[model samples]
Target chain A: MSRIVLEGISKIFGSKQVEGVELIRQGKRKAEIAAACGAVVGLCDISFDIVEGEILTLMGLSGSGKSTLLRCMNRLVEPSCGRIMVGDVDVTRLGRKDLLAFRQKTFGMVFQHFALLPNRTILSNVGFGLELKNVPAARWNEAAMQAIELVGLKGWEAKYPHELSGGMQQRAGLARALAADAEVLLMDEAFSALDPLIRRDMQSELRDLQQKLKKTIVFVSHDLDEAVALGGRIVLMKDGEVVQIGQPEEIVARPATEYVARFVEHIDRAAVMRAGQVADRSAPVLQPTLTVAEARIRIAGEGGDAWLVADDDRRFVGCLLAARLAAARPSETVASLLEASGEAVAAESRLDALLARVAAEGCVAVVDPDGRLIGGVGSRDVVRALAAHSAESQAGDHPETSILQQTAGAERWTGASRNFPSTRSATKASTGSPTMALG
Target chain B: MLTTALVAVPPWVFIGLAALATYRIGGRKIGLLTLFGLLFLWNLRLWQATVETLVLVSLSTITALVIGIPVGIWFALSRRAWRTFSPILDMMQTLPSFVYLIPALPFFGLGAVSACFATIVFSVPPVIRLTALGIRNVPTELVEASDAFGGSTTQKLFKVQLPLALPTIMAGVNQTMMLALSMVVIAAMIGAGGLGRAVWQSIQRLEAGAGFEAGIGIVILAVILDRSTQALAARARPHGAA
Candidate 1:
């Protein structure tokens, strides 16, 4: 179930909000509404759901209302008009006292700056929420110590905020939120201020922490790489409206608009696309017990230099090279001709990690956790995916694609597709019955 | 009562108490130097007068801080209250110390209490202004964080805002004590006896050597009070509860 849902949320920064809201309902864009009523639209009818225990990233360039939208969740920056439901409660209608309690119990917030009280020690800062509620010192201190240990600052709890490095300070900030044990965490550009290497470390640490804690986290970031690193669904915003909402792979593969296409122009597809997504599921699956003569007939109409051979249970045995199969005895089993050169990777492995394997082996098989083959990722399939991604991003000026093009060996890979020998080319022509007849 | 003690107490006892306090606050070197300076004042025959000035300055600074800190806190927490009271504080600060003494004489008559009253009026502004500035200058982000964490208005004020603002407020207290010390000589014009009376007597009889002795005695008292309070304020610096 969706843990938090925002409906028709709109925030106008200036007066004439009534008129501004009316124009927004009439489908006026931010600038048009601003010109018409002299009220700046901060969020224009923004709506989305935050599923429970998912790290949903609200991503955009600065001034795109991503942070504003995040604040709207806890009503820190109240939405001008909307219905916000966390569980069954209508958060928009919560009174000051009730809202304060609800926010304290439900939402934990981490900011761009660490925001640790400079006067307080790390332990006190972490336990600040509990101390606010007048919890006994023993209980709050115990909770604070646990959180500090969780963030790897166990001994530093007695130190001042200024004594720690920027990264450690942010860890303390995160520990402060964790100490409260809130069901949801709203992290607003939490790692953006850190040095790049530390920023990456924090991202991974957050990812690991979220997995263990299972907190419904809404992360806000301007960097797409950070969003992808968090490995969550992303809601891309532009000009106070959601542009597209999907996983990084879906968004990169099929951007919903030109604005979104431009936003993802420099995204490293290898990092976002998983091995499963890149695997060619249409490839013929050969049975291990099938005769070499029968396997030759099965792949004769296909365009692969080799076929992934799997048993009846779809357990991947190995690959059978076409040349090796052709040289074998007619009565020999396909398993007997199987080549050990092919690599098998977990389906969840990222495409960047699979690229080196792809370069080494002509094709790599993608398997589930149980080691059952899902499909194969060949050089042609990778080249095709890269070409499509580059073409989409090429609508804008993407200078970074030169690196990908070089690494992909664009000419050799693309030429391999066009000038492939006909003997191994079958699926492109005899698509229907021939391959199925052998099966 | 403090005046009676100053008159009855022996010179060595006063120096001994001061040295102990200075040792606690400013550490050994400063404490010994202050004791040496006090011994010089005793040799100059100004110990009684110096103690009287110390009593007056100490009493007035404590009173000013007690009154000024709360008023500053009230101003910091409420914009409306600040707007209303800021101009009055401005007027109190701008009006000369002698002008305050003119009104103070009729109200309290010529005495130590009247001198304390006038000196407080003269020195209270720095504490109030600085305390308000400290609270007001607390980072908005920390306040928002406190609020987000469910801290009530009172909780935030005491636990987060005030604690964070202490160093800045202590700086104000230091300023207030210095200002109070400066007002002591002027305060003596209204028959408030202390080092000021000793200086006043020398000026009247055209006694240059006595005047110089009393002047140096006041400087010595000022140094002790100034250095001790400054040391206290420095010690009070918020070091993350460490």
Candidate 2:
């Protein structure tokens, strides 16, 4: 379900002015001020849905209005024209008192500079947001302490900001956000200022917390890699408009635009696509099968190279491989050789998770959430995804379908290729039988 | 000699106490230096006149600080008050000290009160200027941080800004005290008894040794007061806790 929505949001800045001398020269009664500071269209016609419990990253360079867009979500910077709906409430139209209440309950913000109070200790700074909402001092303190512990700053709660290291200060900022217990978290380049090592640590910590809390997060970052690592769905932005929004793999494998492709070109795709992409599927039918050796030969001869071992109802029981038939015993079911293919199948996983899954499974299969196969992928898939992504990226044009098409052509051959009759016959049959080709 | 006793004891005694305070605060080397300077003035026999001058300077500096700090706070909190009073502050700082006696003597009799009044007019500027500057210079980001944390106006001012501004304000106080010390000797011309009276008496008699002694005592008092106040200011700083 969409937890938040922005529609037709636009912001323009300027005030009208009058020029008296010009008016007098023109023989006018009044010289009116045109809205002449020259309007700055900070955000123009921006609309998107952030699904519940998803990390939707808003990625763009400075002056690209990513920050402004994020700020608009919380009404920190009001949009000149738009509607922002969070759940059932229209946040854009909130009055001052209602807006304060909305902010207190709906969102917690983490900024680039940490913004911890210099005079207060870490505990107090973290509790500050809660304090503003008028939480009782004792309750807020306890909540703030838990938040501090959550961020792993348990022993350092008494220290002032100046006494802490830069990373610790940032952690305290995270703790402040956590303490608020708001439903939506807004991060504006929250880790940009920290050293690289600390930034990575904070990113992982945020990922871990997000997993546990399931809060809808809108993170803004200029770094594409960070976006790929953290975003469940990325909203690539340029010049105050959304360029693309999709799962990281979709952006990496099939970027919607040149600007998006430029971002995706550098990403490693094997790490972004899931195990289901390459997972071997069970054959559709169940038979009173022969010995494993006899079955392998018969299936190979019939052009059904991979065989499924299923119970009577045709439920997927296990898989059998042609290459392993010699080692199989007659009494042993195919389940013995079904070696747990550790590949992740989800298409929405990040590059880091994809990489980890690929490394674990040797090659991951990409699949939809229902466990239906989408495509087979290997290390070469990662290379090709990256190359195709980058090739079109370097061309700085529309989506690079040709490079991906070429790579897909190269990877079409497998151990099962020998079982299929002829490419010409297969092509002819594919034209008439789409379901057969899919199977 | 009796007149010398009345004039000399206060400046010399006060300076001696200041030298002791500096030695305690700043340690041995500064203490020895302060002690030697005091001894040099005593040897010159101008210590009596110096004591009298120290009394007037001390009185004026204290008075200026008391009046200046509240006005500085007012200026810091209210922009309108600052804008209105800034020109008056400018006038106070730029106006000549000598001109103060012209108007002051007519209202107050020629003695400690009139001399103190002249010293206050001359010395008060540094304290006020520094206090205002100190408060103004506090980081705006820090102020915002406090505001974000839900600090009330009073809490923000007292807890965050005031403590941070203290060192700068003390620096101003130190400077003001230095100016007041310098003006006391000049104020002696208005029949304020002090080292200045001794110098005047010595000059009338053409007694070079007596005048030189009184001048030396004034110099010793000046050094002691300046050094002690500087030490105090330094000690008041945030870093001093370490």
Number of the top-ranking candidate, with DockQ as the measure: 1
Provide backbone clash counts, one per model: 4, 23
lDDT by residue (tens digit), candidate 2, B93-170? 788778778777998988878988988988988888788888887876455444434455666687667877887898
lDDT (0-100) at residue A426 of candidate 2? 14
Docking class of 2: incorrect
Q: Each prediction's TM-score against the native?
A: 0.87, 0.71
Instruction: Estimate, for each residue in A357-410, the C-alpha lDDT of model 1 and write its tens digit.
Output: 776666788898788888888877787667756654454544334323533333
Q: How much does candidate 1 score in TM-score?
A: 0.87
Give the chain B TM-score for each candidate.
Answer: 0.93, 0.86
Q: What's the C-alpha lDDT at position B154 in model 2?
A: 69
Residue pairs in collision within model 1: A301-A426, A301-A427, A302-A426, A302-A427
Runs off by more than 4 Å, candidate 1 = A14-26, A293-305, A311-316, A326-331, A339-348, A367-374, A397-439, B240-242
lDDT of each: 0.82, 0.67
